[model samples]
Target: MKKRGWLYFLIFAFILGYTYTALVYNGIWFKFTDGLKTIHFLLYFVWFFVAFFLSLTLHELGHFFAFLFQGIKLRALYITVFVFHKTNKGWRFTIKPKLWVLLGGLVVPDLGEIKSDEDLEKVHKKFANSLVVAPIVTCVFLFIVILTFILSLIYSRSDNWIGFISIFTIYTILLSSLYIYSFTLSNPMFYGDFVAYKKMKEDPVFQLAQISQYTMFSLEDSDETNTYLWEKTRDTLKTIPLKNSIFHIMLLTNYLDGIIRSDQEIDLQIDKKIQHLSISHYMRNEQGLMLAYDLCYYHYKQKNVAKAYQLFDEIQRRVSKKLDPKLTTYYKKKSMHIMHIEYQDEFLEQIDNYYVGNSWIFESLMDPYETLKEYHEKLPFIEYSLPVKFEEETWCFQKSMLYHTKR
Candidate 1:
């Protein structure tokens, strides 16, 4: 069984065992017949859900309002439970959102257009301040609810009003505690807002983030052709130690770009680094897809055509069916490229339009063709680009021969 499947099975078994003990051993099922007890339970259940949702909404609004107060323009606002808004793109619906972004209630701000160092510094400060506002707002509202509950008790209020206050107070406190835990705790499952806020204040982290943004812009920046700035930025990224998955992925992207440019053979050093990333880390969907594509390219270079095809097929199948149109179109183009299928000029034009419209540099960075090679490698690295074309021709010929023999 898959690890995830086994985990689900274990959870199911534990729940079943607990239910059996409660109902059969303890005879707790009889409690359902007690009308007053049942009513109280239902009321608490309803109140809990209502309070929890309200608290989460307020927490997110706190961040949103903070950004507005600081005069920062937000690119997007996402809430895991059916809320998504992007500046130009408007709203989108999807089953799952990025885990870290959803958990942290990340508000992506439009800082890429700010060229001046003074503007960048001001934006970063506001962004950092906004991160803390969610937790603070949650705590403040929780305190107000607790005070109201105390006032109701002091006045010896009617039973219904007392019950209402009591339930709201308990639920607000519980929900607020959960929010606090999510902010303060460091878990491998997802990053917390407090940790990100702290990192944003550090010079190295700030610079790295800025470099990543610029690298993204370079991919879709129409008027800019000189890659000298990109080369320098990449070198700067390399100077930082690969301490986390994000850094490792960024460095791997640099190496992958080198591979596509060189095309002669799989670089052993790059291949080793690709293999070093853990399976769990690769499960981070977007980055995982990029890593999968890199591995597929390596296999194709090694003349392992069947393995390359299989890897591409698996990743294409696993991609979210409800992805944004730009992403869906990009992945389709990628799958075709991996399979060595030629595309019409119109299709390529549409892809270019999508890239420019979406400002999608990360997707562009993963392209295994002349476009990415041109953007990533210059003059001295130009010679490396020849071998990739040769490999693609070789793989296509091999595939044709195999089909003919089978026929």
Candidate 2:
């Protein structure tokens, strides 16, 4: 239904765009032969794309500078299809990107730690700067584009000016439409900068969640770091009412707590809470898989093979149906291997084949699993450590940013 809506929207958009062009350039239509010749059209195309991308870059940089203005150091910036991400090794540039990122570029601020109200407020102020500044920048650019279009109209006396006027008109209209749509539209799952800013101002839970999510993403992979996060999150959860919004964060906290503390009763409590939360909340594909993998491990550790298999069945029903078969099978096998126990070497080989350079998942799931310690010993010790690809890295960043606080 969502896809159908977007398809209908695109069809409507195309028709509307054609109608607008026909109306605006009625006078210039006769000059098409002189104005829209191959060379001229290519030049116009190049110029439009360059200006469009430049505007997008400036808008994202507005967010970047705003965060920096609040003294928040940034870790990553995504503009269009390009990504500038930082890791332990250093900052690296990546080409492949994520969807919806092109609508408004993303900046990942390094939110050091969320230890106090002061810390939370500090992050809030920094994010608020970006939300406020980026839209302002966008509007400013839109105004400039409109002004240029108006100027082209004012001087459209020559056949040479025909293409310029028409193209600028298209750019102006397209930019305006996108600006309005992005700023105003709201949904249960997604909202834009303007609405987000309003929520930041009006809702404290939304505000705290925004801050906590980034703070979680900024964590280094270490027992001490995980332990600290578990304690702090445990404290934060005590203060706020438990809700579906913070379930993923709680799931992560519980997973880390189980590893660090190894208390069976607490682990069982965490597993039950996770199962309850999974049933209550809607988890999208990759996000659902993250939770499923954790729960699968918990069930297996509890020596409940039936429960582990049941979890996989539920995954197939609710989440894995939407996922790539390879990805689904990979995670399924990784989780089920705990019970099968005989195909340890085959599983290790598969891990070597697919899990290389995916340090976050490895450290979070496999390395910490006590059942896998023997397999780890058998395998040649190679660092399963490298920064994740652009999509997964952005997922971690956005997942934490969007879902890390109690409502």
Candidate 3:
């Protein structure tokens, strides 16, 4: 569409980079992560999410401009950017003139238009244009805004108006530019919007999908469960897409199948692509969807006791309230169920005690398959802990977590 392959290039590069590094590190998770001095790199990972949010804001702002250009109205423009903190209840990034803070992943882009299905059809096409052009324009404008603001600050005038204006413009542009850069990588994961542009123009199924993609809580209508786009409804533009249109649900379903069913034959690129994609609000929710279940299951199967416990805690907050009913039963009724860390901690404590006393525990933990198998054999089989040793320090993790295994 935009020949904007460069925008996504970095996503691919990072995916390959992260996957390679993870494989190398998996071979030596304890050694690499716990190595001499990686404070800088680890910090970079944490801060990288900030850049991600900024890019998202810029992308959506582009959509806002696109809608305006086509004479469609915007009811709301939510910029879901937030700094990571334990207690903040509002938008994390704020304008000095009027700032706001939020917990992570709260920036929701909501666009509203006139009350007519016909209007929605017209606006839908405009949205496709905005999806492609707006982000590009937003990036160019932001870069200039940030650059001008940088130059503006050099020539300070006590004419308070000049200084204030310069600072205001600088913050907005800098924030936006940082965001645009994040999306403007060489290998993008969410090239579907670009793909959708060509495909949706002809396929009304894709066009109707745009609506359902964002609105998941509500149904298509009171009568039909798997409803396609409803023609008579006044606010039909915002109607939720079918389950088939739910990107996160589909991708996650596939990912879970990979680790649970032991489909190692499936390439990591196919499984983890969701993490790299930069796209619609619906898709972002799919990011990191399979972290907990995969790791816990794998470690238990391998009989590693310690690593599984920590992984459970790390990913517990993302607990899904619902799942495919069969999977819910399969995961829950499994021989080694560590789904609820809170319920099984006392038992895991006893297992941790056994490892601490056993010096050859290192050798025991090294046997990944044996590690999982033994843990599964244990009563009430909790998350098997794999206490990995790197030099002097001891770190715990599960076998299924998948890191680079360096020789």
Candidate 4:
């Protein structure tokens, strides 16, 4: 009932719907006459799942053994995550172990039918002591694989049983080791970002839980990445943020990342982050900075010298004393350097036009002349947005002309 991360709850709900739809479409359930066929598919699915899950079992076992040696109490072991999103099942766990040696469930089998959040809390509390055994198990497997590979080479000359075992174990051990690493590796996007698991791993508090959590509490661990479409959107947002939020805020690292990058990379990452602006209002500054720049450039590129200069001036005024004061100066000089040639008097006058009001964009677009106005219009997370949005909207004269003509 706690209201924390209601967004995550929504996401979980959406995933639930998506998963059910996929299963139904794929004949996971059945009418009475088709029930036998359904059972056959279910059985094979269960068998393969059981075999794969056994690997996670061993992973958790490694952690549980470490806990036992360290004299920690084990409350329960179960495959915790069930019917999550698109997947029929997932893993979570409950264990009472010491503080520093957490990560136990990662080496043992996960739980089944997690009874309550209380079960999770009990496990969460024990994280500090659990042993993160996945890495240990993985490294051992790696060493075994390497040893087998070397031995295989050595015994390839002899045709002995040891050589055969070494070759066979190489493949098994390599796959196991890869699975273990996938669980604990630090990825930089989505759930893989520095925020959740990686942050937990870095922090002593949650790092302790990595063991038990990975074994039964987490499933489908991959190095999360920005798909091309998402990355493109994020890059667009990085260059411009005032217009809209395109993605869920929770999944917006790539967009934010693009904003923080340079002009060279900005064009690439904006489209992704645009999808997720609603994630946080506090992030307005991060998102807005790039948008401010993009707006200025948009106007600049479109030959809308008036609008362009207005946007530029807005950026100049909002420049933080903590930031590079020289940045505003640099861009100003660059502006004069580029525009001074064509629209000599017009561009020069617009450069100094510090009319601090909402009408900056309107005046820029409509060519309205105004005296110094009051300053009640500084929107948070940005110095100006109307200027940028106006500029982006008007950047393509061809598009503008076509639309206006069609009108």
Candidate 5:
């Protein structure tokens, strides 16, 4: 286990022990028949649950509205229970929610669309404000609750309401403290917003972030050729250390793309680096989908048909389950693309006969070499000299043909 894992385990054990001792001391451990005690317990449980839900909701809204107030357009706002979005057509809501999304809403700004120095500065300011606003709003609301609780104690003649308010106030304050910790504490699984903001303030870090966003946009957009994006990704990875799983996975994606395009040979060193990284700690479901595709491709290339088929089957099973339809479609399309490359003639014949109605199947069947030459003729194909055992392998079949034909 990593240091973070150990720390979390110890904390859990401590909490469990403390809770057990407290329940025993209060004579409430396994005493379900005590009606009065049960009522009090139920009331406090309901109050704390409500307080936590409200606190978390307000905390996320703090970040969401902060971004809007700073003139930043959020692509999506997630509050754990649902994802809210403003699309080109109109607003949309989705029920898919993640724990990280609920703890502090993710504010994805159009950072790649920044075109000027002024725009960059505005974004940096807005990003920083968004990070700080959640904790700030949470603290302010907690203070208000605390003050109200105190006032009720001093001025209220009704003891019952005051007691309930006091407990509610305490729970709210505890929830706020957790909210602050979620963003400030360093964990192997997720970085706090404050930490991310601080890293973004650095020039190299900011440049890498910008480049990553651009790379993703190029990959997902309608543009066919990612030659420029591939080059930018390669150059940026050289300068940035693979300190985090996000960057590491970005590099892996670039590497996988290069291999698929036949622009670079598989590097064992790069593969070794990825193997060493803790991918599960940082990878989301979408990223996992991409990783699965890459692994399927890799296994196929290495002549491990069983493993490749297993991976593909797993992906298909996941698609049949409750995954987002859009995401499932994407994974299926990409997986088919990989299979098309590995089993060119077989896949082509299968698709040609069985999937004639599928537009995506037809699109994926287009000759990659022709597609690359058409969109990116000016860009030179990158050649990597691998170790002696991996000699004679090259990427970009069309680029190689064009080069030799020109010579």
Candidate 6:
């Protein structure tokens, strides 16, 4: 574990230990043995949870409103697994629950459409405000709680003292948690509000990395964008530290730009470089997924059928268990059949369905789907053996190194 992770763990463990000692050793558990006592305990327990979720919701809304005020378009807002995103069709709701998301909620802004350094900087400032706003809201809530506690002490009647005390005690705990949350999430490991704010303010490399990723996802891979994006990404790559996880993204974008521009001198070993980074300890799951998506295509284009199928199978296994596989996984069986002409019709049909079905999602897949169509139109006759279906004994072991290696 990272040092920050250990500190967080110890903090939590200490809180739990102290709570346990209070309940069991200090006679608090015995005091709650009767019916009224049990009901009082239950009331406080329920109130604690209710207050906790309510505060979290307000914190995220602070980001949502901040984006609105900053004139930054909202991509999606997430509260645990549930997501609400803007689409051409309309706003839509979907569940995208993951282990990490269960801890907090956040709003995702539409920064994908950046076209130049000016656009990037404008979005960066707006995005920084969104991050800062959430923590400010949390602090405000803590301040309100402290004020309420002080007011209760001064104004409450003797008969109402117990009720005021109970409420204050719960709020006090929530306020303490909010403080801890602000401090803990500020660690870069969480990539939470403070970390994002710090990175945006202090690191030019991080700023350029953000643009590089958004450009790859949003920009059309035509002559207009290829040259400009390639130059920017190359400059970013030159300066980014090797240990940064986004260094892989810069490399991938550079490689993609080269392909789009038809650069004959482009390094053919780009996939190998990405594969090396995908196995690193710092690689994130989403990054691994993006790398796997590209690697499958690269290996297939290279006539390395076995490796392509292996990559595709891993993606398939991950997506199969998802509640909404279409939104999460790009390549279905039909999409995978694009390489072979036999399933060309099915592939085209599936692509149409995917576009129509996912029109409400935040990110657009039009460019990628069009690219697939173009490939289908011009793929020449080439003899190649069919790939075997991949089978791995352990799901954990078979997971992308990016997923398994994150600290």
The numbered model that scores best in lDDT is: 2
Q: What's each prediction's TM-score? A: 0.53, 0.62, 0.31, 0.26, 0.52, 0.56
lDDT string for model 1 (126-211, tens) is 77788788888888998899887766655632556666766778778887888888787765334466875786677544444444
Task: Give, for candidate 1, the lowest lDDT window spanning 10 residues.
Answer: 376-385
The model with the greater TM-score, 4 or 6, is 6
lDDT for each residue of candidate 5 in 1-407, tens digit (9 for 90 to 100): 69999999999999999988976776544342232232476798889878977887788788878877877655666565556665566667766433433344454454344434464566666677777787788888999999887566546655566667767887897877776776676553366767766755664444444444533322134232344445445555555555545455655566666765455655565555544544333334555556656666665665555666666776675533444565555446545554542222343333323222112211211333333233221122222233565335454676799899999
Tens digits of per-residue lDDT, candidate 2, 16-76, equal 9997688558753455445444236567777677667777787789888998888777777
Q: Per-residue CA lDDT of candidate 6, range 1-407, in tens? A: 69999999999999999987876785543333322232455677676666766677888899999988988667667676667766667678777544243577757665555557776678778777777888788777777776665455445444344354446456656655754466446433246667778887777666665545544333233444445556565555555433435545545545553553344233434434445543333223444444455556555556676776676666666543423454343344443555452454654556644432332332332345665445333223346675676667565566766586884
**Candidate 6, poorest ten consecutive residues by summed lDDT:** 356-365
TM-score of 5: 0.52
The order of the candidates by TM-score, greatest first, is: 2, 6, 1, 5, 3, 4
lDDT of 4 by residue, 83-182 (tens): 1111223333223223113222222323222233454344433433344454466557556656765554433444334333443454456556556545
- lDDT of candidate 2 at residue 301, scale 0 to 100: 54
Error of 3 at 255 (Å): 20
Which model, 4 or 5, shows the larger TM-score?
Answer: 5
Give the least accurate 10-residue stretch of model 2, judged by summed lDDT. Answer: 375-384
**Cα RMSD to the true fold for all candidates:** 13.2, 16.6, 23.2, 25.4, 13.9, 14.4
Q: Which ten residues in a row have the lowest lDDT in candidate 3?
A: 356-365
Off by over 4 Å in 6: 1-39, 81-83, 89-101, 158-165, 168-172, 175-179, 182-189, 209-231, 238-247, 250-286, 289-407
Clashes by residue pair, model 2:
213-400
State residue 27's C-alpha deviation in candidate 6, in Å. Answer: 22
In model 3, the runs with Cα more than 4 Å from the true position are 1-77, 81-123, 133-137, 143-178, 184-208, 215-226, 230-407
